[model samples]
Target: MPGRFFLTDPMAAVADALNVEVGVVGNEPARRNIAPGQEIVVFDGALSRMRWGIVPVGRVNARGRPVMEQIINARSETVFDKSAFEGVGRAVIPVNGWYEWTGEKRRKTAWRIAPKGGGFLYFAAITDVWTAPGGMNVPQVAAVTCAPNGDVAPIHHRMGVLLERDDLTVWMGDDLDAAKALMLPSPEGRLEISEAGDVDWDGV
Candidate 1:
């Protein structure tokens, strides 16, 4: 249930934290509701503008729209073998915090979860290149998800993969398998989450 999230800090701050030069996402507006299929900033020391969902080429609908099979989140266990993510579709997302919801099934309650001190977090993700409906090359990415660890488990069953500093190089390297291994749950004691100040699912 880890779906919506936020990136409150500027992309430059995130680059500083990752020890990489700030790339093209200069002074981007902080998104309080980051939905799929939109361009988002993701960098594993190489900040790039990546669309939110990964749509493999040649998999288009009857209308010629690229088919998106709910791939906004990839399972850590099967990310490598999944035919959809095997080639030219690996990436990482730099995020400060993400959102998860909990409440009665009929009435969803969205909560924002962030680090204790608002530090930067890099979420492991996969990317793909696709021709747009109008025949334009587009690159997109989705946050990798796994069984939550420590504190994030109680709020929801799934959590985005947050990478450690040392792992960034390998996570975004040439070896796909090596980067896939980094998709496992975040290291123990690496993250903390709390109830957001508000739980407004519909409000901005």
Candidate 2:
């Protein structure tokens, strides 16, 4: 799954491609490394910024235990069925690409994955709002993951569930079954993966 993402394209391009108004996400600068817990651009219906990790403040698991950690990615197999995910809204995370690591911790190789034809890859995501002690509402999101397609299998066992441009409405609509139907692996040959050794992880 994607632990970090990149969106070097301009916000205007993203707004134009998605055919939605940029609204409050104005004049956003290009980002090369967006990590978990960082605010990211999301299109639920209109473009907006939301924290990348879902803070399960009062959520509980199926076993009735409190969800202990923040969720950066949710498994597609149980996203809808899990007790902890109930009432979450559906959204999409549009990105230029994402980074994945392989091998051991100190010897890991970084891989950059993006759409083969050079456009945005819309990741299916779930949304929520965390109410802090002062009653401030914090919107958040988590990318949904599924079994990897042939293109990504060598690098990772799972990949984020990608959505077609035409299916964006269906994924964000109120139809549960229709949204669930779109949670499959992206087809092979749709992605291009390469070694990403030049990224300045600390600068972005």
Among these predictions, the greatest TM-score belongs to: 2
Highest-scoring model, lDDT: 2
Candidate 1 residue runs with Cα over 4 Å from true position: 57-70, 198-204
> Across residues 1-204, which tens digit of lDDT does each residue of candidate 1 receive?
357767778777877887778767876887766777677888745777888877676655446666567468888887776556656556678777788778889876666677666687778887777778898888778788888887777778888888777788898888877876777667666555666665444643
Worst 10 residues of 2 by lDDT: 195-204
Each model's lDDT = 0.73, 0.93
Per-prediction TM-score to the true structure, in the order listed: 0.84, 0.97
Q: Write the per-residue lDDT of candidate 2 for residues 1-204, one digit (tens) a residue.
A: 998999999998999999888789877789988999899999999999999999888888878899868999999999999888899999999999999999998999999999988989999999999997899999999999999999999999999999999999999998999999999999899899999878987767
Cα-based lDDT at residue 73, candidate 2? 100
What residue pairs clash in candidate 2, if any at all? none
